[model samples]
Target: MNAPTTPSTALDKHTGEPLRPTDGQLALAEAVRNGETRETHGTQTVPASRYTDPAHFEAEKRALFDRLPQVLCPSALLPEPGMAVPHDQTGRPLLITRDKQGEAHVFLNVCQHRGTRLVEGEDVQCSSKLVCPYHAWTYQLDGRLLALPRADTFPGLDKAQYGLKELPSCEAGGLIWFSPQADADFSLAETLGEDFSAFAMEQSFLFRRRTHTVKGNWKLIMDAFLESYHVLRLHANTIGPFFKDGITAGDTVGPHMRSAVGRLEEVEGVDFTDMAALRRVITFAYQLLPATVIVPSPDYVNVMVLMPQAHDLTLVEDFMLIPEAPATDKARDHWERSWALLDGGVFGSEDFRAAELGQQGLESGAVDHITLGTLEGGIKRFDETVQEYLRAVN
Candidate 1:
């Protein structure tokens, strides 16, 4: 017998070649090589239009959400046949189920007749068919039209042609991704690029989740996560002291970014050796393009993905994942402590507060344009990507 060959390691089969870094990315990389650091105070601010313009928001829906390969829903949540999940933001019912042969199928959750929504919850198990509640329209697990209540009442009804509408979907990183538009030519790996696969995301699991409605543009929420410059002032009592001065950041294309906060040796009571050990206790944070932030701490991993609802409202979901099994209670306890600290200190406090303020400022028309300085390389790259995506769609 031949040993199984590993999956192909070439540039993603769909994208043609490895993605190139954007000009903003190249400049950030060069700055990193020169040992440039973040400034204590930002001199440039992002333009308010980036957060407040309705045209820009519509463009984002087309270029970023419709065209990108993002993991909008998790696959594990729909493991069984007959499961249905509703995406309230998109007003599309998402149906997940297995065929008679047990292959997974995903389709838009709407009945072909009169467009009534078919499914209503996170997950549901069905034995053979999904019966629509509105008029008893039934569909097979494979999405073929199974039955109609009044077949003879309607003439020229084509059962073969009236099946459930299907969406383009692919599963990766343990999540189900579907494109809202049918004709989009983007592939998941191609849109995210080859470098994203380097994060070893499959090794992680979900451990904690918090979702909330915030009064802010989703971009404002994302901006809160991209840079650590505010750590010294806003998070001073929490994560500030742990992060040393001289923090640096770099950017990559496809809108992906990387930033690092230094842990120096000169802090008054903190020991570098101990801090290095603690740094291993938490994975470094890396921001995926558009809306996901993944933090791989030594003891646990945390991720946040923001979905936009309206220009002024957003849905933010956060998840914490730890190793499936810890060797000892002490090890498990250590992770628990780290999770609590992060939850209360960062996510629960300063992070959301700053976004709330930024949201209010945009709403109040207090500023028309916010600037981006050399210190905010990550934010600069993010703004540029937003602009490019807007232009691509518009």
Candidate 2:
């Protein structure tokens, strides 16, 4: 990988640290100032078959999903050693654990003998070994086969050869990432880029997690988040009042995106004393390449992990991250209120409803393609990124 690039030249006065790219400094500044965003070189109409065909869906799993690196969760999920997390995804049963050394590891969640899932539930904390329930075969947090019941019964058995298969894993910017296959010198820093390291991803704790199964393609689920063109009509009763119509600006870091939108608070002229003041007024979203999205909100960042179940179904895990766990009942109440307002009102009612409806339309064979305007450039870039990856693979 090439050397990392320097972060933005703008520095915060208080910390002497580089400020995260703000709407004031990033690509959308001029357009955002004029209430416009960058347009594509030309309008592109993507075929509807890309969303409906089974062959194309399978190709995507192999070309995009299987080969690319994917996010597991935030590092805060495992604050201490011995913390274990089990995830049910598209392929093999997978589990994650922080070892005694405080290092995170990802592994196939199956036991070698009978292939029972090593961990039963969503998460756990074990100071010792992870024991398989099927045969009581035990393995260490770092993937070493420790012991099993009646070890003497096996002839020429090698514990070293039977250890759990570890997957490629890395942690950076307070988040964990993994790839289905391992690369000896895989660098998350290279894949994510230097700009990601610049942001202060504080010691945020997961507050409320809500998982939902949506009747829409995974890409369709993601596309809803990429464009703000329908905010006014779709989110009329919810967050639309807070944001201007189709007024968003963003730039891509490789396939990853960081977009900023003008909040109602920023509409009137305001001066900032520090970077902290600036962050309060604007909304920034980081659409991590392929499938994850992290939108840093006023109180918490909403982390959305989209897992494709089938061509027409998607499993989304939505996590709300706060700087610290709520210490008071009032604080918890405030979080609950905010979550209900955003997730229930905006996402559930506004964004997701649109996707399901769109899926019904596409599957009806009524439309051959979906049109993209210059305003929805972010959505175009996402499709282009997938095409680029698939082309190289093919």
> Candidates' lDDT values, in order?
0.60, 0.72
- Model 1 sits at a Cα RMSD from the real structure of 8.5
Give, for candidate 2, the lowest lDDT window spanning 10 residues. 1-10
Instruction: Determine which window of 10 residues in candidate 1 has minimal summed lDDT.
Output: 1-10
**Per-prediction TM-score:** 0.72, 0.86
Report the C-alpha lDDT of model 2 over 188-302, residue by residue, as the tens digit: 4344533333344435677877777789888887887787777777877777767754357777765777777775336445333233443455566777766888876644667
Q: After best superposition, candidate 1 residue 287: deviation in angstroms?
A: 3.5
Overall local distance difference test of candidate 2:
0.72
Pairs with steric clashes in candidate 2:
none
Q: How many clashing pairs per prediction, in order?
A: 13, 0
